[model samples]
Target: MGASCLTDTGHEMGSISLTDTAHEMGASSLTDTGHEMGTSTLTDTGHEMGSSSLTDTGHEMGSFSLTDTGHEMGSSSLTDTGHEVGSISLTDPGHEMGSISLTDTGHEMGSISLTDTGHEMGSITLTDTGHEMGSISLTDTGQEMGSISLTDTGHTMGASSLTDTGHEMGSISLTDTGQEMGSISLTDTGHTMGASSLTDTGHEMGSISLTDTGHEMGSISLTDTGHEMGSSSLTDTGHEMASGSLTDTGHEMGSSSLTDTGHEMSSISLTNTGH
Candidate 1:
């Protein structure tokens, strides 16, 4: 059995269970075993094998489940197999992707086994299980790549990770089990460098480690058997060099060590007893 319902201004439906049910243009709620919905609110149990689509120009939803597609221009809340355009909380294997305006943009995302990518020049909290790459403008004309925490074998690159007008950066942590090369902290005019920690077993060559102008460095530690050459851990002028320690037997050259200028030095320990 099936039911066809239509409402131009407003409509409300409850406790609907059918194989093929169509609804359009209004507010509605369905607790169906399998059905279809359009431009309305739904509390579906097994709709289209737990797959439903919704286009919300302005509406609100609470505790949704299964596969549901919603284009929200206002606000909503979703869980598992759902896509939202406005603001929502989603969790599932399905990818949650959207493009928000600069004036109206704010997201708090936590992805366990999915990739969430968004291009909003506002405040965002992105946690990706895969690769997440985008550019954001925090303030006026100053782009900032907010706190990034990656745990997979992917690369995250931002054109400009800045905070102030002078382009300052916060911190970056890449904890991968494989080889990760060329990880830079800060690279801007008059920009300082934050702490960099690389704990990989593979070779890390030509790694600047930490190079800043007119700023101080935190620390540098190389605990791998791979050779680290051409590492520039030298400062230009009015800068102090922190303690250098190599725990690996591999050779470390000035071209591969971290270098700074016009700033205070923290400490560098290369405890590699072989060298």
Candidate 2:
């Protein structure tokens, strides 16, 4: 059954429902369940669920939900047993499995995994992980494994393996078997980790590594085995690794590492590991 001059689902489900100014001003739509859904704007679109979708100008207060999972502005996926999850304007997917994993804006990065006996698992990815670059990961021992991946521009984890991870920012990989990991700016890794990594502003900055857990910064062109950076230069590897001119700002980790891992960020020769 249809309704007024407005058109479409007008008064079809319920009174004042799906009435798009058929005769009034701001008309609202009702769901199949008989619940009042969203209101229509001037030229914008109304809200819809299931077979009905919301689209148009700004999407204002559009919302969506499926399989008991819901989303306010972005998207949310709840497996087995989970709760409310949200991402930013870019791309950030939050997940859980009998557990909950969340992140803010500046705190965009990494993953959260959990495992016990039999539980649902999932992973989340952020379009923008770092200040303007990178990626992240997280994992647990539960059947449910949640991961958070981010965008990259400054720092990145070529391939990260995180376990029992936490919040990650900038670019860093909390990989390996760790008890509990925290945040970072660039690329990083460890066995028992907890800290942030930093990247460079110019080209490939530098990279860092940690056994007990720490942060790594710079640009790159290689693997983040132990967390490291190589700003605006070629390539290099190692724990606390740093190559290029002002590679490591001034912290030599390996036998032939860079000198300055900070500013004065210049170039470097294969022989001159230092500035």
lDDT values of the candidates? 0.28, 0.26
RMSD of each: 15.5, 16.3
lDDT by residue (19-53, candidate 1, tens digit) is 22322312322232212213333332222222333
Candidate 1 runs further than 4 Å off: 1-149, 153-170, 178-195, 202-263, 273-275
Identify the runs in model 2 with alpha carbons over 4 angstroms from their true place.
1-99, 102-127, 130-135, 142-161, 164-202, 205-247, 250-274
Provide the clash count, candidate 1.
26
lDDT of 2: 0.26
lDDT of 2 at 191: 22
Residues 31-85, model 2: lDDT tens digits: 2221222332111121221111211111111222212121111222211111111
Candidate 2 has a TM-score of 0.24
Clash counts per candidate, in order, are 26, 61
